[model samples]
Target: MSDLLARHRAVMPNWLALYYQDPIEIVSGKGNRVVDAAGKSYLDFFAGILTNMIGYDVAEVREAVERQLATGVVHTSTVYLLRGQIELAEKIARLSGIPDAKVFFTNSGTEANETALLLATYARKSDQVLAMRQSYHGRSFGAISVTSNRSWKNNSLSPLNVHFLHGADRHLTQFKGLSDAGYIAACVDDLRHVLATAVAGDVAALIAEPIQGVGGFTMAPDGLFAAYQEVLAAEGILFISDEVQTGWGRTGSAFFGIQNHGVTPDMMTFAKGLGNGFAVGGVVARGDLMDAPHAVGLATFGGNPIAMAAANATLDFVLSHDLQANAARTGAIILDGLRAAAPRFPIVGDVRGKGLMFAIELVDPETGAPAPALAARYMEETRSLGLLAGKGGLYGHAMRMAPPLTLTEDEAREGLAILVTALENIS
Candidate 1:
């Protein structure tokens, strides 16, 4: 075993999973590629688990961080009025789409979700919350209660009364083979029943991920959430869209994934991608909802100037360069490539996703059962052949490709080709 791996295994928790039979230690990166300690460069399909939105060596983001750090004050906390923080908050509020939206920054997606939960439970005066089966919010005492991915939820006890709904394909298996409209209606019916039976029309909120990130890029019909929101609104249940993975035009069709549903959520939380590898996350909501708390709520590392500077620059780069449109164009090509290749690979049970966020489900060729072993083999093979993908699913049988939104046509096709070769070898 490598010395680093030995040390990592000895020190890190067993649950802190690393990829591949022999993991590569990425030391430096540029564009959409990273060079490991052994000097092997790989097309970074996962983008550090979709955190590096604009990719590495971005002069704009680096310069902004440098410019902020040059003043020597990295963090003054939220206690002080900050120019960079205000600038980012204003930009986020405007783009958030929630009427009279107010932004509250946190250091990670988990904290952002925790803040949302606190606000929701407090405002509505109920601990009852709704979440979809096979969804993942974060790994926190409060966050895990609402998160339904079986593998990720470790604790049986929870603070909130989180009821898992049949929101998407995993739990809505009975809706399979139905038309999109029919499937959506079925999910809506299931939700209404759950609210009636489980929460008794007194739920605080329904937290949803427009695209279930750790549940293997699982998404329902676009209108499903809109339908659910209509019902939740009738009962005064706030809708919290967890945009940690699907935010910032990752879905291609919309700036925020929930926008595709044609319903504005009561609140939304975001973390990854905004800082382009830096830790910056926040919750944006209706002014009334965000102001519901009677006590002061502040994060020490929230909206730190350096992180805000990086985020402001990254957002500017994402919008100015029209990377959203690029994701739509390049992602369509990659999606097409996967669909065309899937028929030849028996282990590939399904291919789905939009924009740069995509997934391929591996299964036993003979029984069509979830094949997590096959999934690992694909990851190892892909890394060996110069591509790094991500893994997650209800059963850990999904190979996810969420490259930086700045990926070019050449890079998209290059990554796609490498993925197909990996599939061929693994299948």
Candidate 2:
């Protein structure tokens, strides 16, 4: 393990952080559990950073990939006609709920978002974009420019003129005390104010995550985006929903997180869970906007046969097993359990999220200030207890848990028990 760590540090970029004080190399995974190189089995609550939507080593997905391998054709790009890519694109376009929708495949969420941004700018004929504060899009330069989280935003240089808006993080906003409806109204008003003062003309688009993933699962009030959509429509500003983490029924109540806000965006970007750990990401947009790009655009590895096969199989398994319903039911159980445990753990300042995506924000008990150290200790302790969860927040003080959508009641209870014990130990 020491040798591996030394080699990793020597070869990999320093910014690529690994988990745990002693990082454990994961060897294999089945269902909701994974075995580390040390042969210790752990209940994987993070689900490979929420990429394994159904579960690990799903036979259906495995068989699909195996069948594709037997065909001996995998690298056919978008330049060639690939049946799997077409089928997956058709499935996604139909599921997108945008009228006359079209789908474009990419290799990752970051690229998908970049494609959306490019389409938006070209269609709207403007480079000014609006993004929510304390939100994250991706790691690329274009993505980072729109991302408002200071920790993730490495530099100020950007290609687009980006403006950060309020209402993404209610806990840190001035409208925290307002009721839901009042809060939405205040945010909309602030958005209007920003448009008048910041934007010079018609903005390209407003890109947002229904639930801020890296921002600790923070969510705006219900119908908040819908209200913003109404305003954007008046100005011909496009609305882009960054559904990378919130897509594919992980949010429990809906197939897409933006559905929770009762709004259908002009464009939506998805990745992470779609291919069930395989590299597949895409953008779904209206036909007119999708065809707006004049020059030819193509991705080298986009729409590969293997990725499409995996995504097709993963989507099939998710729908056939009704994992969305499972996510809703099990998510409520975990959410309630965490909320109930919050009072007992003084370090827990807030618990917020939807479906399987939830977070526990840590705080100093007396001052109520973010306690990043305590959060780190909690994460380490949880891992030691045979469970693997994730941590995220603007201040790095949130304990994020996004188990597989197929998590059983038994697994949920066991994870809750372990988390409760971890909190007790921390206290």
Candidate 3:
């Protein structure tokens, strides 16, 4: 262990060391399982934050990548005719069923989000960005400026025009003045107020994760987004959905997270699950929006050959194998089991989210406050028992479960059993 640590410290950059990682050294992955250097296998319930939609070490993707490698070099400028990029763009467009839509690929979630912001700003010709409080939208400087995480900004960004709003705060807040319906109504009304009072040419776009991925997997109240869409459309504000975490069948649906809300965004960003663990991200814009002049937004790695091949394979696997429907089916069982388990545990406050992208929020039974410490402890205990879990929510009290869509029924049940054991031990 000392020798390995020495080797890592000697070769790796210190900036990466700033982040916390599990002590175990992962060597490889196969399907829904990953093996450490010591060869211990654990059910990957978190799926690398829900990026491995089709599971790890998928044969089709490996074969596709190998074929691409055999043909020629991986990276090439898209200024020329590129078969991989053209094929992926066509596949994504067909999967989305959108007309004359254009795709802009990038290297990661933040870059994809940054691209979307640029496109929206270019289209609307404004600076202000509206986002939901507690939402996670990547860490790019521009993306972080629009994101509501204060700690991430670190006061480095100047004059950020991010306006934060409550997402389902009507249900969470204890104020007696507003009913639940009225609370949701007020949230929408607040957006309307922002649009009305904010000076013209101030707000560029209203961006949100339709499912609020890291923000406790919170869903907007029914009809909330439809109502919000009306306000944004009337204000000439472009709607941007950051689906970097929720897109590509992880949410048990097709297309964007906004589809769940029954509204279409002017532009959408995607990263996780697009390449099934490969480094690929992209932005899909509406036809009219994409018609905006080029040269304003382009990436060297965007729509490159290797990344595009992986994405093409991932999309083929997802569609042909019905991974989205599988997620929906398996997710229902997990949600039911969790809801039943919640009643038995005093700390389990709520179980919510769409499909595999769900969470079990923990709270102190005595005070009804978020039990973040307890949740962290529970994660450690679960990992010790050979299950990998994730944390979410604003305060990080939510136990997030976003296993690979390829997870079998037995594997899911085993993971849930591990969770139940952890909850029992914590209690």
For model 1, state the Cα shift of residue 348 in Å. Answer: 1.1
Model 3 local distance difference test score? 0.78
Residue 82 of model 3, lDDT score: 79
What lDDT does each candidate get? 0.91, 0.92, 0.78
Q: Per-residue lDDT of 1-427 in model 2, one digit per residue for the tens? A: 9999999999999999899899999999999999999999999999888898888999999999999999999787888888998899899999889999999999999999999999999998899999999899999999999999999988999989999888766776576678889889988999999998988987999999999999888889889999999999999999999999999999889999999999999999999999999999999999999987779888779889999999999998888888888988888888899998798877899988888898989999998999999999999999999999999999999999899988999998898899889999999
True-structure RMSD, every candidate: 1.1, 0.8, 2.4
**Decoy 2 TM-score against native:** 0.99
Question: What TM-score fits each model?
Answer: 0.98, 0.99, 0.93
Per-residue accuracy of model 1 over 332-414 as CA lDDT, tens digit each = 98999999999998899999998999999999999898999999888889999998899988999999889999999999999
Best by lDDT: 2
Query: In model 1, which residue pairs have backbone atoms overlapping below 3 Å?
Result: none
Candidate 2, residue 381: Cα displacement in angstroms equals: 0.8
Off by over 4 Å in 1: 170-173
Worst 10 residues of 1 by lDDT: 167-176
Better of 1 and 2 by TM-score: 2
lDDT of model 2 at position 167: 71
